[model samples]
Target: MTDQAVFPRLASLAGRLVTARGWKRLGLAALAGALATLSLPPLHALPLLWVAFPALVWLLRGSDRPKTDFTIGLAFAIGHHVPGLYWISAALFTDIGRFWFMLPASLLGLPAVLGLFLGVGTVAYGWARRRWGLTGWVEAAGLALAWVAVEYARGHMFTGFPWNLIGYGWVPVLPVLQTVSVIGIYGLSLLTVLAAALPATLVATKPSWRPALAGLLGLALLAGWGGWRMAGQGLGDVPDVRLRIVQPNIPQALKWKEEAKINNLRRLIDMSGAEGWDRVTHVIWPETAVPYFLSSDSDNPDQAPLTRLLTQIAPPGGALITGANRLATNEAGDYIYFNSLFALTQGGTVVASFDKAHLVPFGEYLPLRGLLPKGVKAVAAAADFSAGPGPRAVSLPGAPAASPLICYEVIFPGAVMPREGERPHWLLNLTNDAWYGQTAGPHQHFAITAVRAVEEGVPLVRAANTGISGVIDAYGRVRGALPLGDSGNLDISLPQRAETVPLYADYGDAVPVVIWLALLLGIAAFRPRPT
Candidate 1:
């Protein structure tokens, strides 16, 4: 064939691929989802979503039945999550002797379950497209709304696991991420899906670049506004308070062992008392730094041995914040456990405490516990940990008032703020990333923590076991950090809060709600002329 003929042929083949049916269409969607996964943390190639989302839109457009569309979405999610969450299996290897049986389930089962949300969203998108007789940009808009809705639902459904929302793609690019402060992460996500899928309109039967151009313009504005904010926003340092975050690099396998408890506690004390101990006002420790059950003696108000130790490490007038397991009894007489953070004074007094409200489904407690045999244990806890009252601002002496986020609680976007009263000046996130090894999990967790800081317009102080601990300014800039698998203390002054509260922090998810309504109204107003 001549050069001109060959070029046209390739274009024709590309068109056919977009309109393919059955397994071929499903394969394309799967491929697109896999590509989209690359845009997530550890390999933050966010531009890949431009190709991936367009492919998804094409698959959604070509599917004639809701069942087929559901499968297409499921395939996409499987492709997206299998690789996206592969690091989840890292926790299993920590106890290979017992958890070896769960390796396959750990690797594939989670994605399979989480993909159901995507499948439902696709089914809705297919129904809406067919019901409205929608096409082109209108169809793209509808799909974007549905996709964002599902992502939001995924973040909230069944205790919520919004690990790698589409908005997180912009995490590595700090300027683009500043938009989250205005609209929150879900709002950014709505725009992300729309911008990514808008390219599909260019390939439609009646190809028009107008929608694609609009998407590009929106993206340019996002970048420009973020750059302006970064330039103009005057983020200052809060006076008087200072921080000393200790990353003990404790191994997960031995953390709960009886023999290692004393040594582990000693390690945290040693790290906290390093060279700068006398100067710091707050000494922070990772989640569950004390391996023993802290609440076992909760009934009494007297000082526990752990409290005595913290007093020794903290300066004369300083406070210590650390994580531990607390126990309590329910009305039924069964003992319930909690992952908690305690702020202790140098005189061995418990000044304040915040129990973790959001628990990792399998890691902290098994879901559908009644269905599982009693012998089946959770990955991290032998007994299920009960949920506490949600996020609250815990007051520490000499230090600024702050909200406490134990372990995975920091992953939730708008949900991280205190339930009532004035917003805290900073966020204290205590986590143990040791379970997932030194893999993508910790990196992804750290990125999510940074986004929370920007969204709330508050500085974030993260202390992690075996990892990625750092002091992030309100603008998502890392002032100081101890890298993953490193045992050390990061001494830094606290970053000041923005003088004005960010729009998202004031009105959480209100922007996304407005976008959802707009999409619905567009679908209702859209009228196709009779043939």
Candidate 2:
């Protein structure tokens, strides 16, 4: 299994790439990063990771110092994240009149901030590799550990934005995708990076082939176990809880217009009450679907009619769950707003409500509004939204207990669980992707949201404005979905939550952290490679 025996030419070419300097080193690194992005959602070119990652290994390899490592990783990550997340700026275009200037910041600024995590992670990896003189498969393992650690950091740092975890590349590879049920996304990411980087060993040395072989063996075991898990296909349905998700496809520009408010509300009602409403035990709407003030005590004069207007689609004993802008006066006597979910009975009573806790940094509320430019306020923060108590679940008359995740709130791992009393039967994610329009942002968002079901071992029903509304069962299967920009109501029986909780559900990210530490310890055992 010497380099000459199998990958002599690959080894030779990589040796050359590994010695690249100056702009060429960074250019190749950027290229490798961009190539890896093809594995992301909307285009699942997964095997490209094999090519991209090893090249990245060499790119990091060519750089010798910790400072050099930081720049390389930052370049690589910015290349990866910018293109992968370019669609994020599409939101600004939705309100070009106001958000016209924020476009560049959304496109480049956000990714730069996120990419810093990778830069820092690489610094750690570089220090470890140099400190231990790590090589071959152990070197690959070292890189994978750093990658996953930073990914975990990215998801949690600063209210967290866990978009496009590398594990998501397996979206098209469902059998392998099942691995997330045990390891969670971060764990899946660890294995994915390990496996993908193994090919890099081809050019390194003789023993590297063993690790490469081991990686293949690992994938086989994972895929086979996943296949067995999938074979038990008779995932039962939650009895009596027929659900309907409505996607009104309201245009973002007119969604908040005074003239179009009634029409938008009427459209959602009509669609929900369309032909199949009779069999639906519960109805769902996307984030802020009820763009009007809903509570009777709210300042808006039309609050009473708004509540009764929502009941038109509610079943006799069932409830209609919709996202609304909740109004309240904080203890300081200042008017505060909350992006919240409200459940209403057929009698028009507001039964339960959950405020979104993990608000988007500049989207739901500005971080420091007073210090910014005179009129520089967040798009949704006409009045900054006050943070909620925490994750919560609600028990309505007709549906099983459900935890509602508003918009990007569903992206956080383990945090989706209800803190109330018991684990809920399902996850309800209400998102308004209308801001992103018909773009990869929503598609990626939907894929990311669907995977949460597997992590939590529960059914996830997502209602989205402007599309991607559907049902994801416990196994992460998209049982039903409405495409982006489609205006319709999807009716389906609610899939039952898995009888057993997933390892990820029980351990959250602890499962992945153990894997990372075990590998680090293994690499530590190998004496410094005679540096």
Candidate 3:
């Protein structure tokens, strides 16, 4: 046989093998992303998610083009988000059909959008490879830096949905999570991306064994540093006041109904009574725990029962805080309903109230109402609820001044408490998670609360309507919790004030911003050669 003919046959066989391997890599990447999703709350397989990312980086390194890398990343995102956000569809089963369509859109849309960040990172990695013929340590560092930039963009763009950050997967790994006190969640996310991309450096390039060894050593060093920090940082002293968190477990279908109003108030009052409020310093009810408008209807009929229960449970020193719909008549003669938290003394006298400022788009208020059909407007609330003005911090008599965050507000990183010198001592997050049912919604929601506690260096006392009611210390430790899907009261001690503020609380994700700028400059500096 001629040498040319033999060479062609050998080349064809090699090409087929390479194609098969590429498909395998893509499959592995998808599997890894899906596995990582399970590590989040409601599953608690956190270690599994960490392993998945490195596996994904390894799989993607086999592909040379930007488009191929994007496809693999997209597949992984779909797998990760479909199960991770399945609870979003639970709202669809309610009265609104529009919610069903919107649920899928948001569930798929968010991940799809976030996956673009990964695509950008991978494209940059491929570009760097071709530009400098970089491999091993150089490739790994560049790709890690590129991914950090992507995470930063996802956090800041389009009102910024920073849920399920790679660092959050490290929640179960306490020592690593403690690092948040210094760098905040963004820094941890950068570290996570770096760690996950380390294995890719070894697999993708031909380099001396020393470079691979260095990459391995770097990961070990991070883990070791985290473990040391965890050991050194002990739980600070417990607070003087005892907090009681109440989870009503009310169904969303009947929550706002006129008929259910009386029964719901009675149920909450009964639960509070059972806790023996005399012993507890503060009693908390989940968001919108009261179905009726507390400020409207002088003859509510149910008020007598609620007042009686409060008088019975609330001792002279104790105070009661409950979630209710408060109505205020504006200058326009329209009755504005606010999802508010009201504090009351033993005699049912209103102490102070905080109206929710950060309302959920489409859920609490619809955007672009003028353009919508009249029929759609009729089906929705009369109009969007107006945003409350200023920070609502109320002195709880004997306890610390508490800053209230209703529902989705808890998810926003630094937005929970007042800025700088005006910061509150503790965070009170009241939410009704019943809308999302038993899916990952409640778990993910709870996770955000924990992160908030760590970020602000404030203990969070959270009350959820359906389940996952608990008390989280300053360091994101769940000191006490009620199981999901259960109706119960959790009595726990809040952590005392930490003299020092967390870096995140003071700086507010500044590190991620800097990283994003650096990555942009890096990309602009290096131009890709024409194919």
The C-alpha TM-scores of every prediction are: 0.94, 0.96, 0.83
RMSD of each: 3.0, 2.2, 5.6
Model 1 residue 195 distance off true place after TM-score fit, in angstroms = 0.8
Summed over model 3, clashes come to 1
**Ranking under lDDT, best-scoring first?**
2, 1, 3
Which scores higher on lDDT, 1 or 3?
Answer: 1
Alpha-carbon local distance difference test for all models = 0.84, 0.84, 0.69
| Ranking of all predicted structures according to TM-score, beginning with the best and ending with the worst | 2, 1, 3
TM-score of 2: 0.96
lDDT of 2 by residue, 202-254 (tens): 77645356777888799889998988888877688987888889999998888
Error of 1 at 529 (Å): 3.3
Better of 1 and 2 by TM-score: 2
TM-score of 1: 0.94
Model 1 Cα lDDT, one tens digit per residue, 355-382: 8898888888889999997789889888
Give the TM-score comparing model 3 with the true structure, all chains together: 0.83
